[model samples]
Target chain A: MSSTHIVSIYDEELKYLSRRISEMGGTAEQMVADSVRALVSADAALAQKVISEDVILDNAERQINEKAIVTIAKRQPMAADLREIMGTIRIAAELERVGDLGKNTAKRVIAVQSSGMPRKLARGLEHLAELALMQLKEVLDVFATRSVDKAKAIRERDDEIDAIYTSLFRELLTYMMEDPRNITPCTHLLFCAKNIERIGDHATNIAETIYYMATGSQPEGERPKDDTSTSVVTADVSEASE
Target chain B: MSSTHIVSIYDEELKYLSRRISEMGGTAEQMVADSVRALVSADAALAQKVISEDVILDNAERQINEKAIVTIAKRQPMAADLREIMGTIRIAAELERVGDLGKNTAKRVIAVQSSGMPRKLARGLEHLAELALMQLKEVLDVFATRSVDKAKAIRERDDEIDAIYTSLFRELLTYMMEDPRNITPCTHLLFCAKNIERIGDHATNIAETIYYMATGSQPEGERPKDDTSTSVVTADVSEASE
Candidate 1:
């Protein structure tokens, strides 16, 4: 942003777009934290609040997209400028998806209103939430500062969230097996845990975007894919489809 | 794509992007079908083929994105033209994610190599795959034809996939409970089912993009959300976070 340009208003448009993205990042972070709280407490009211707040995140994304498109039309930015603007659109879209994940998680607070969640796993989920939110915050900073190193660090931490999620999946399975009663509520937590895990993924996606925007080169090498959710298939057969 | 323009090359550029997107969509649909074949047949080699083919989809998306941005920068397309290019970008991105889902589903073929999957569930997954691919095929046609009505119809069908997924979830859970040994494989199928369901979601997203591009207006009313995953939360209390 500091790269001096002849047209000051071009700079202004970019700055305004950045500000909207910042607002979106902040809202997404709050939505994550609040959704977890509502989940743990089964506070439907708080869950409702998280749902309503998603509109703000959506609005923020719209503003950023509109401004970015208009700026592109007006400035006809290429290479770095185009990448920078496209990066905002990508980040804003990721943030909005995060908002949806939060809303979906928050909705779970009301979904299991009859049976209580496993008390023991509450700490585990909170720990996972802390890890994901930390990642979200760090990625947002990377976006603001255009720090490739910071973006890479955030990208690497996505595995830690996945690890936590993998373990939680087993624990929930055990709970369900030990008592049939645990099945209903634990399944809810399972999906919610996956939601939080996916939030970490969005952060990683943003980190990649920031790195590409700054370097004009995508970070090389495959992203670490440690989520063992893939290991669930086995022997079966079906007639082939044309 | 057929509208004659003063700059014939501009039309050509847009057509090329569209052709790439169509290729991507076709490849993604094939990947889904192949992944299911691998899953049902427990054919790791076929799964590997599906996994390997994903690069084609990814490369298609990248090509479309780069070309679209360049066209916009050079053409400075406004209104419908701008929306057309942006829509291609959005659709390609969605197609890429669909490819990822297919790859992940294919990977499950390798993950479940240790044990045999339930024979009963293969049909369930194939059914889900059929529905999703059908939706994908229909939506791509909508994009090609620029038919908002077709897009709207595809959007409404998303709930049907969700409904099928919810039932499949129950069926898998029941299978797991009836036999503890079923847990591992059923869990894998559970993730696979969700992945297929998510493919339907990407199709719906593409439909929305088509709707917007054709009409220059986002469709009104809430998207049908019938996934029973939302009904899992209940009463609980824990120390809330700041």
Candidate 2:
């Protein structure tokens, strides 16, 4: 075969590999969502399913990596192509981590069940999980479409999750404070919140990865202005009120 | 320059870059240790010093990146050399994060001082910081030497840190339970313990990265073992005790 034909074959293979990776990302995101849902709802069956499905995600990751290696070995792809392969490898690794997070959430759900926690706390957890899932879906959309604007919007959603996490932390703190009996259950719920928050972070990481792939630049999030005038006044007022 | 001479120059430059990265790692590890010491001992001067020295670690990271890019563009490194450069980039990033952890600990110390928490709680937090610092030191040693055995040993140390974290959690829980007035200070200490625990996790991450760089194989840390028998026994014993 001519060198050009070989190059064409490798290009085709690269396209296939890229699509496979994106599909794997989709599956992993779903797994994470489902795992969180299981934890929030105490769906033992769903938790088990998520744990078992992890093998499929693992397989997808392995296949993507193998294809990348084979393409590199056979085609000796240069700069831009090499970057794409590397990005695919990194995204695959990140997606695999997402799958692990899902499995961890599922395991925590099992632990919480075994610990005999009250089920009423699941309502807030379910809300947090849904928000995290929305963020993951948006991030995957950004990845699939290479939508820079969408990626930025998804990045903004991280603040929403952060706010939720803060509220959840305070709520759980109050729960534990109300009674020592609430400690173990609240702790488990706190871990569930943490796992969901981490899912949001992973989605943010995907957004950053998308931004890098599209522009070869890291997007710096705008830092909150350090204008301390309001904070100062508030501190003084609180002191005066005290 | 002849191609051979250019290659020689590139090799030397790569070696120098790696050496500098290793040196930065050493500095970061030391900074973490001293920052924890300052926090535990309530050494205001040492805390201030750590906050200042963070700039040096930041500069080292910048230098490492600049050198890596120069070598990559000029030397045209092949696959293995490229992986080495990439590893250095990642290692530098991790080291920068370690530096940030130190700065964070120092900031927390200052915050605690400002809030006028009891000096006794600082002692417990100091022990937590020491545990974290020890784990980080071992992780860096493992990274510098690329000792798989050492990496495994560092993983064990992480368990000790986790144990300390659990006890610290219980201690903080007791404080918060004692009086609602104690909530703010105890919560601050809890955050301090959490920061230390997270620092230990970062160390473990670096250890995992080192294992990858040294062996070019993923470590098996995430697999769920079937310890059903132990779990059952423990469950029964706990039930009986309860």
**Alpha carbon lDDT of residue A120, candidate 2?**
50
Interface RMSD of 1: 6.5
C-alpha lDDT of all candidate models, in order: 0.82, 0.66
Per-candidate TM equals 0.89, 0.76
Model 1, B14-125: lDDT tens per residue? Answer: 8898888888988999999999999888899999999899889877877787788778877888788888988888899899999999998888776655666666677888
What is the Å distance of residue B50 in model 1 from its true position?
2.0
Return the clash pairs for model 2, or none: none
Q: Which DockQ-derived CAPRI band holds candidate 1?
A: acceptable
Clashes of 1: 10
TM-score, cand. 2 = 0.76
Worst 10 residues of 1 chain B by lDDT: B233-242
Residue A79 CA error for candidate 2 (Å)? 4.0
- Top candidate by DockQ: 1
RMSD of 1: 6.6
- Candidate 1, A1-242: lDDT as tens digits: 55466468898898999988998989999999999998888889999999899889877877787788778877878788988998899889899999999998988786665667767788899999999999999988888888889888888888889889888877776765665555557777778898999999899989988998988766888886846655533232211100
